[model samples]
Target: MDTLALKILFMVGFIAAWAIRTPYQKRDKQTKRLAARLVLRERVLFVLIYVGMVILPLIYVFSPWLSPADYHSSLWAGYLGAIFFAISLWLLWRSHHDLGRNWSPTLEIREGHTFVSSGIYQKIRHPMYAAFWLWCVAQALLLPNWVAGLAGMISFGIMYVLRISNEEQMMLQHFGEEYKAYMQRTKRLIPYLF
Candidate 1:
């Protein structure tokens, strides 16, 4: 398929995946918020990531931008991008499934949110973030524009750097020795390789 077709396909899948989870996420959000609220930096980072990963890419793909022909990768690369996207979709769904009510858009913990360390979470403390990273890689490969292609990594990179430690700290505070033990056994985003 052509680049536009591929972009459309990927975006549709991405949006659909989120749409399927929207109801669950909304229900999850209605729960009472506990401690460890999202700081301003985390909020700002999320906004930047949404813009860079979603809005910017949509504009760059549909509108005429500096997406020079030189930046467009080979057809093989697009196929690879599709593969990455598929992996992202699977990981995203599984992350949500494993997280269940434990999932939150922000850093805040839910009432009765158990420390999860099974399924995808068994080896990766943040599979959703891993999914997002895969999405970024897929975006970079699928999109041709330098700005659109790299925006996801840049956007998520900032959040990952600033928020990960804080998140782990919050988890540590809440789960204490259990979380620390989990950390000792599991890597942050990758499995047995971080």
Candidate 2:
């Protein structure tokens, strides 16, 4: 497919993702937080993630500023990206649906947070992150721009690396042995293999 078509597809996926998260985000604001680690570093990383995943990609889609960094990808790759995008959307929905009120944008436990170990959470500790990895792969294939395409992975990778251990530690502190057993049974992002 042509680059314009690919960009349109990416936008559709992006909008769909936003649609999926909007209600959850709205609801999360009403949920009381029992614990939070929204430190300055975390806040900065979150902003970087937004810049990489949302701003840069949107700029690439809407303007020619990133065209100098554009690279041609195979048509098949774009098709593969569409598939990945679809799966990512499904996983995103499932993750949010399964977690429900337990979901939060930041590192915090809600007042009535429960240990979720069902559905997508059954095999992996973080289906949402897995969905994001797929989304990043999809973006790289769909955008065709070096900076915009790869930014999601780069920024999210940094955040994941810096935050995942702390996230798990928080879970450990909250759930204690239950989380440890869950950790023993499930991989962080992948199932069985990782």
Candidate 3:
């Protein structure tokens, strides 16, 4: 019963976010025409990534019961997680600010959408995803609640895994040589040497 309640709470938050921002921000990827070029493995991987994050934590929390005492963390570790998460949040904020009208929940790249190569984009291609992952790690560390932390990290990771690959493929199809050059110039998710 307790586990189910926690799962409900987690889902409520996820649904709330998807509802509040995703619908309004969605844009067309224009590169969907290149769908023929995508590999079957990639498509399968994408689905797995999406569902994995959503369901993985549920397995641990809602399916198998766990408690606070079942998990543990040090204050220092929590603090470190907080710092990393703060950095991640900052990155996420900047990504949103920079994206402006180009933001969307689904894979949508507008007809006039140009690749962003400046600001945080200069260092990392997927600052938003990186931020999400970082925040997940932070949540996991700070909460020290196995279920909550796992859900945060897993869901965020799943989103990133799907979005990054899809976004990259779309960019490659849309921007072509320019995107290639940019990829060479900047890292994928990490800022340096990643």
Candidate 4:
């Protein structure tokens, strides 16, 4: 398929995946306080970063931001990045699967929610963030142009800061000491060594 068609197909799949995988709902969240709780910057970053991650790789297959040149990768870098990318994506899918009815695109906790400390959660508190960072670093190695790759890296970095801050605050507010204990036990992005 062509670039535009591929982009459309990927985007459709992305949205559909989220729609199907996300088990949370917006029952009475039309309130102003609840609305205000969702940080606009974080929300925008989530959208932009996610779209950029998907679209950037698609561009590699579609558009030519820059032609492939004499870009070389160390064997170690390729092996490590590919391994991390695959593992990270699997962790993400697992985290989302385990989250089930508790998953939200933004940082809103459902009423009477329980903290998740199972599956990928036991290994890392934020597998989703880990996946994102893995994706950025992986793309930097996988893609040819420094410009395209750097865009993903920079955007993910900014988004990571915002996402961690906002998500942590929400976690604290919703999960309280239970989450604090989890935080003490697990690192944020990295697993055992952060």
For model 1, the local distance difference test gives 0.84
Write the residue-wise lDDT of candidate 3 on 109-141 in tens digits: 554466777778888888887876775675565
Give the winner by TM-score: 2 or 3: 2
lDDT of 1 at 63: 77
Please write out the lDDT profile of model 1 over residues 65-107, one tens digit for every residue. Answer: 6456426468877888888988988998999988888888888
| Candidate 4: tens digits of C-alpha lDDT, residues 1-194 | 23243334334434543554444444324322332355777578867776567666566546765545325445565555555556655766777877765666666665545688998889788877786677667666555455555557887888777667778888888779998898999988677798
How far off is model 2, as Cα RMSD? 0.8
Ranking by TM-score: 2, 1, 4, 3
- Which candidate number would show the highest lDDT if scored against the true structure? 2
lDDT pick, better of 1 and 4: 1
Instruction: State each model's CA lDDT, in order.
Output: 0.84, 0.94, 0.61, 0.63
TM-score of 3: 0.66
User: Could you tell me the TM-score of candidate 2?
Assistant: 0.98
RMSD of each: 1.7, 0.8, 5.7, 5.3
TM-score of each: 0.93, 0.98, 0.66, 0.73
The local lDDT score (0 to 100) that residue 43 gets in candidate 1 is 78
